[model samples]
Target: MYETFGAVVQGPRVEFHLFLPDNARDPSQYFRGGSPRIKQIHVRGDFQDAVGSQNWSLDQTFKMQRLEHPHGWLYKLAIEQDLNDGYYQYKYFVEFENGTQRWVSDPIAKYGGNDQNENSAFVIGGRHTVVHPIARRRPPRDLVIYETHLDDFTAAFRHDKTPVDAFRERLDYLQELGVNAIEFMPWTAWPGSGFSWGYDPVAFFSVENRYVDDPAKPADKLVKLMELINDLHERGMQVIMDGVFNHVRAGNDPNLGFPYRWLYQVPSDSPFIGAFAGGGFFEEFDYQNNCVAEFIRDVCLYWLDRFQLDGIRFDYTLGFFRQGDAGVGIAKLIADLHQSLNQTGRSNVALFIEHLTDNRFEAIRDTNDIGAAGCWFDPFMFKHFEYCRNGNIDSGILRILNANLDFAPGKEPVTYLENHDHSSIMQEAGGRGRWFKTQPAAIALMTAPGAVMLHHGQEFGQEEWLPGSGDGRVVPRPLRWEESPLGGDAIGTRLFGLYQRLIAIRQRHPALRSPNFFPFPFNHPEGYGAFPEQDVVIYHRWGQAEDGGFERFIIVVNYSDFDQRIDIPFATDGHWEDLLNGGVVFVDNQKLRRQKINSNWGRIYYRKA
Candidate 1:
């Protein structure tokens, strides 16, 4: 078994493993290129059950012993000690070689935490497993992932319970939308104690206590979250957690700081802190150190084993991996994770990254080497955003839709129009007045290719604009479900019905899920661009049918203000069902001439030969 860091419960005793590398190395040029050695270490807390006395006295501390396996020893762990079966809070006090010391929370703490202050704590028998079995895995391309924040997604629906339970309370609403997967924006504890889009992560191994109705009992926080996961799995919905391993929150001050960033007397001497390929945001982790990679690798592994998550979306890859790093940084971490997953007989668990970098369309291509299934389709989102606003795709829409056309077999794209980082579809459609403009975009999102994503409240046209950058972007905007089609909004009603129908169409057509795609090989037009002048784009997707034939589908998209007529290239001459408006048309000549596509709308025709 892989060695676990943090307070790991082993039967009657707990093993507290701490990783601080460069212990016994020669001093180099930089300040403690060779980190200063720790003269003494102690775990002081109220872990012991003392009925008559208060726990966590600074004077009452447990001494630590170093484990030496090589020339430069790495781990300093607490001596094994049996304790009562219950929860306890603790922190580490380490004295370094330069004769300086400080008290800090467990950087790898698995449980127990608050918003402003940090206290490392864990239960004697705390490891939890989801009672509901993991839902059967689905290919990445077949997923319709709905990205939502824990608090905002449920804040408007219900606040009577924790956001996790609130989501469960509103579970049927999401299920009715036909999304098979739910991707939660970084839930590994929020930034400080305040509301966040969750990008600024302070604690990696613990759940944000504020999400719980009762934050005082840290022990209950994790299990309750697990129960929510169990319920999602029971409903045949996959759960994906957004993971931030590139960097952590910095600063020695309270509310939004990390303990490991300033755990030692000489802060820079800490092995896990520094800079690399990470985006210049917050404090980027120095991946040059093996300890950093190992620590995060352990975190991912523990989550998989304990939480039974179906997928994970690595936040940003440009900030995590470096050039020419063959066996280190995120590559090593992903390799280790894949190896572990294979050993555990896990399959079809999606691992994707946000790898928008220099030539990002190509940067995404390189993720195959690091063991990622694919990447967030940044180019696709930007292109479609412009298309939705401008009413056309001047650039080659086929290239964007047929993503990973030249990628390795297993690698694919996770496409989306709006996620946490962008404005809602209503906003992109130039407000609810031009809501019909979003119809084609939504049609393309579901009908084109790859794993699809729906931002929370996007199905019903939630329009709330925040700045593209700075603190203003992180504020919460709860969904207005009452304004949905079922409620009263005119635009929301139409969009919601369209979304439901499109999702149903996608699920009903196997050709939509197939990799076989073409840009309507026109016989007369002799052009492939879905540009403004053309006003129409036709494409075909087909899958090998059970009867040695092909299950074919042709998609017609209209981006202009007026209806356009086109010769749609059908794959077969047979009964074609118009999946969009519900009609049947006979195509005896393998082509439908003067087929009308409405303004800012589309049609999906499924062949029933």
Candidate 2:
């Protein structure tokens, strides 16, 4: 179905197709007289016209025929010639019946120019030379994701803008941190300022040339991106790309000769636009339209096929729904995308969504029988943060700890304490200006029974609020690696060492990664300390043992400022080692071991056989 739209290249002949909605062409529905007549479709590239001139002249332009379809008018063009391999850019030149003409980029191009100027380009017979590493599949439950903006991570060390290749140079450091996957924020081409979170995607298929050393050679970016992916894959790390399909940048008006006007809608009565919301620059995509659907599908497929990415994290699924609806179309779109990607033989390719709704999660669960991964557990983070700051364990914390068991069984939710959107935990903790206080939160996150993630600089304790263009916005900011714990700072060093130990323990222990969470009973008179409602939380993670029993781990946290003692009942009377501090304790009586945990610290005890 996607083949019905966009340009399809076969040998020396290239076929082009464009769909103009019927309503858009109607006189009364759009412009007063009528929509543009689309007099001609013109395409020019390096492979066309001359051998190496790559010039676009009147002689190079050819006329395209308009065919009638059920959807609307379809402009078709077939060009045959002796075109060579490499980078080729093409655009559509259309003349209106009213004698107005405009040059527009190809909406379906696999590559394009920088954010300042959008011109679609693609590789002609250019094959990837880098041998991809053998595909290694890890269970969703075992994933330790590290999310970062590529430029932010690399630019922190360099004076100039960091490119994808420059970011790749830091793979060894990531591998050292023991993160299994890296989630890069939206890298697609966007307009206006180069420093951004990259959520405003103007060209979905093209790489952001702001990070590219050479914008003239479009294929160079593609090659460098591939190299980075291959390098990551070889290091046994998966690559997850952040995708923004909910909306497009809104400045392009139809009257301005923008070709992709049909992709968005700017209704006068749009509720999303207001003084508080900056007049709504995000025009929701026309997902109900077939042309838009195919375009999105092609964009997904292009990255998956070209770069062999491991997964895609779609931004804001709330925007996917139509007005006053139950998001039936949104569910179908996700299901269809999952099915299509699986059909590509990359069945292990993960699909995640940022839909902050319980109904959306249930819908995705119902649609994806194989189980679709959900967003980061925000409630868990918030509740834990509250407990840390207030030094109180409420019902909210208990509910969050037991969420997976009560709500969605057998599904692994991505968990995180801090991400690119909000300020770091240190910043939220009343500007403690130290990462030491956040250790308990970090322990809880890594030890939680699900896939976990750490935002860039979180491991080394980045104290500054995430850099962004404006106040409270996700603009680019310099990452001061010199202040990092790994940079030999005492406080940062302690935090980094603790993180490394916690992550290594999580990776080694199967019980911590298990979906089965058994909250330790603190109701017993002797189990919980003097105050059961104090700032102390305890739980147990277990998995089936080889002997058909359970391999259990007891996790105890002291959120209070002073020291506390937790008398947790052991599954068996034996020696238990504190996984955190590496101290071994012997339990003679069946009652259990009483361990004294330090203030603002936690301990993970694994019962020795």
Candidate 3:
């Protein structure tokens, strides 16, 4: 039987378990000698007050008993009588070989306490946890994603500094953006009780204490998250967590290392900390250890099951992906998740990887081998940027835009022009003044045969010129909603309306979501091909619809400043509705219509079905 680690509330008693596996097959030779030997563990907390002592009194510490497990050894402490009620804060005062001792927080703590000493807390008489069901579920391909950081997103348009106070009300405005999915950046527990991206998570199970309204009552943090997710689901939008499982921040510094890493005498001797790949970004997880894989999988499962998350966007899989090693790492993790999901009858839990390797084909291969919904397709973003900035459009650009060519028969690609990693699309377009150029780019993004994504506020032209420094990501990049269509900036507001219209078109028309992207005009090789000189391209997208008929759409993209008249091929002779601009153009001949498309714009025409 599987048991949960950390503090588990079982009936009237709270049972705490600390996992330290005895690994004979550890890849590290250092594991043999000078390994951490646990002599004793004392539970120090406010509960000691019930035993006639002050809070966190170490006068006579509460000792834990060690027991053998299937994997290795575990330190267990059960508290049923010591709890007199409201809340309790605790930490482990551990003694190792040769009198080497250190204090460490619960590695899998669910809630943090108000202290710089890294304390884990639990509510004694709290009600059982609530698991909210998803209001509406959606498949991966039909998603339009909007990525945002909770702090950056909430910090904007509010002055009182109660970040989540007005958050529920703000969801209505966000729902109007036409995004069916919201991809939030990580909010896991970081080192200090200050601002952080939560990328270097120390406690995988705990939410960042600082993000909550009150650090002492940290369960409110989890409740707020659940409530927010419920709100999004109710609004018909799925939520995707920016899950960072590849590596963790580890060091001797009190404000930098994970509790698990600090528990060992020599941190390097820990099986969970080692070099899995050559990424060298942080303290990477060594998947060679079975316990390490299980621990991370447990962390992932806990969040997904408890929070009722619709999906997870795995951050930086390159840090752990071994060469063709399918047993551990991303492959086994994904396989394990799928098996669990299947057994529970949960469907449409999308898993995407950000293996931004230079070889773009590698993502497709890995996604196929390891079972992921898709990879963040960034090569298209690079090519699209070139076209937007320098008018360097070519046939190769069309090939890249048509993701069907790369991601084959039924595979989906998570395509985006702006994401959390890159600067805003408006910034890449040299400023907000060149907003018109993004019109064609927006059309291409929506009409592309894949899952579309937008960085937060990208719809309303959020611009921030990121520096080359590493601090660029941590810099304040708030959403200027004032620049939106609801705001004052004329140029920024124009792009907002364009995105609204484009998303509506994509949502209503299934042809745009189909896996058919023809580079040639209506698949005619001798017809008007993509002109590199004129910076214009034409393509066709179609899919089989209900009633045994075909739904089709033609997209004419113009990249150059000059308005180009391109021959648009119509399959049927009737009135064609320009979905982007709501203009109707009649077509008598089934051949071609020489249409003059606006500069830095695109035309999407289809029958009103």
Candidate 4:
């Protein structure tokens, strides 16, 4: 039925390898053949042969060669043309001499595809998926990220709606809030009793069918998901999916086998270490093996190539890397993947890791040197929660902040006040009462440092927790629509307004986005105001404004609550306008503004002059 290419006969169990065809320029040239174009490229082989056709426009025309050899044969791809600059998805079909055609996946992907029973490979050309300079060029320092489950976010805006309609309804709402990016809990399909966080997915390559138009066809579902992504892009929204590679769903997984038992790691000598949230211990991938590494790499490439996704948030870093000599370390895994992605010539995508371990800052920091864009910092949440819940500063805050200061500006960490996992916990702790005292801490979370993320429903002050483990006991996670009866009024409105104004201000000013601190002397151990003690964090952004105007602005947040005058020092001596308030302040003479400040609400002074 499909266009026919030649086929190579091969034995069923022989090991075969395929690579991107290389061409040599001269004697000095070490390559083999020219690269292949999807419209023109073709391959036929022994066990399996796949091609990275690079044909993006058509669905079926993009499908390239499929070959199989009954004897022993290997396949190599030669692409004589280039597809210019764009994203591409590729799969291989193997037709045996016995007249049986099969789909073979790319063994090189970080994570494999769901459509192919075997493995479908993927790669990005001259680009890797990264948050663009425009998207985060001027990120809001003070962010009130509303962490919403993708399903819940859609469901909240709909009545008797299908998944397609639900996703379509929330696009404008998400854009209206001016969230820099929306972090969706994993959308990959997984079998569940009902609803799931989507952490235990067997089909990493496919979007969850629950949200698709057909909800039955994998190919059709994938196309629908892509359409949703295109719509989001049209609206100028970046999408980040929570990736759970640490575990897999049993029975449903075909790679591991039906009624799958190899998905979990159990010691031969003892019992299970702990039960995984998705009903399995963990599907441990042997990272040391080249095959395993290739599989993971392909998975990462698939999403970037297929959907043009902005970024990926690795759910649990601890589980990915095993704990021994033979085992691969997280640093190595991240570095290798980063290097491979860098080949695509795209801006470095934000690679954020969830380092929940208190003392593992070093381990996480090393990821940067290995080419990671950044990491998720929990210290922001802990300090804020400690102050909110216990009404006191914890020693842990100062220690972690000081240690984290080692990182250069704009590359420190991904900071957030609450997420789906933690919010659920906070809600349960409140019992009949409020989990976190409705206060100004939300303001502080947005202004803190690194890349910021807001959990869904946070803007609406949604206080219900989703049913799950991890940190669900403290914060509640549920769909609380912005204007619904279940949502709070004054508190939610105030917080939402604060986030909007702050985000707008940050978007207008660059200095506020990438901050540089200038510590002021403090007498006591505890911080007097919102910031850490003596840390009078300052920032300087060097560049022309978006409108091609020269604008210089400075942000001063006094961490001390009591009236304290600190020397204002800078190279330029001139009159600076306090943008937050319509007042001119002398910066040359260090004219300190003194005032009584509240314990939680810190003072922010911006320069206009």
lDDT of 1 by residue, 249-297 (tens): 8766533467666655666666667877746578888777766776788
C-alpha lDDT (0 to 100) for residue 33 of candidate 1: 38
* TM-score for each predicted model, relative to the true structure: 0.91, 0.84, 0.93, 0.65
Q: How accurate is candidate 3 locally (lDDT)?
A: 0.76
Candidate 2 deviant stretches above 4 angstroms: 1-37, 44-60, 67-88, 124-127, 130-134, 158-162, 215-218, 253-259, 262-281, 322-327, 358-371, 466-472, 520-533, 545-549, 592-594
Worst-scoring 10-residue span by lDDT in model 3: 25-34
Superposed Cα deviation of residue 26, candidate 2 (Å): 17
Give the number of the best model, judged by TM-score: 3
Q: What order do you get sorting by TM-score, best first?
A: 3, 1, 2, 4
What is the per-residue lDDT of model 2 for residues 269-343, given as tens digits with 9 covering 90 to 100? 222111221122366665555445556676777776667878788777656654333333355556666777768
Give the clash total for candidate 1. 4
Angstrom error at residue 260, model 2: 2.5
Clashes of each: 4, 3, 0, 74
- Assess candidate 2 and give its lDDT: 0.65
Q: Top lDDT: which candidate number?
A: 3
Q: Rate the local accuracy (lDDT) of all candidates.
A: 0.74, 0.65, 0.76, 0.46
Q: Model 3, 165-278: lDDT tens per residue?
A: 446767876778789999988878777766666687888888776666454444465676677777888788888888898998886763357876777777766777877776
Candidate 3's TM-score reads 0.93
- Predicted candidate 4 versus true structure: per-residue lDDT over 516-552, tens digit per residue: 3323222232222223453343322233455655556
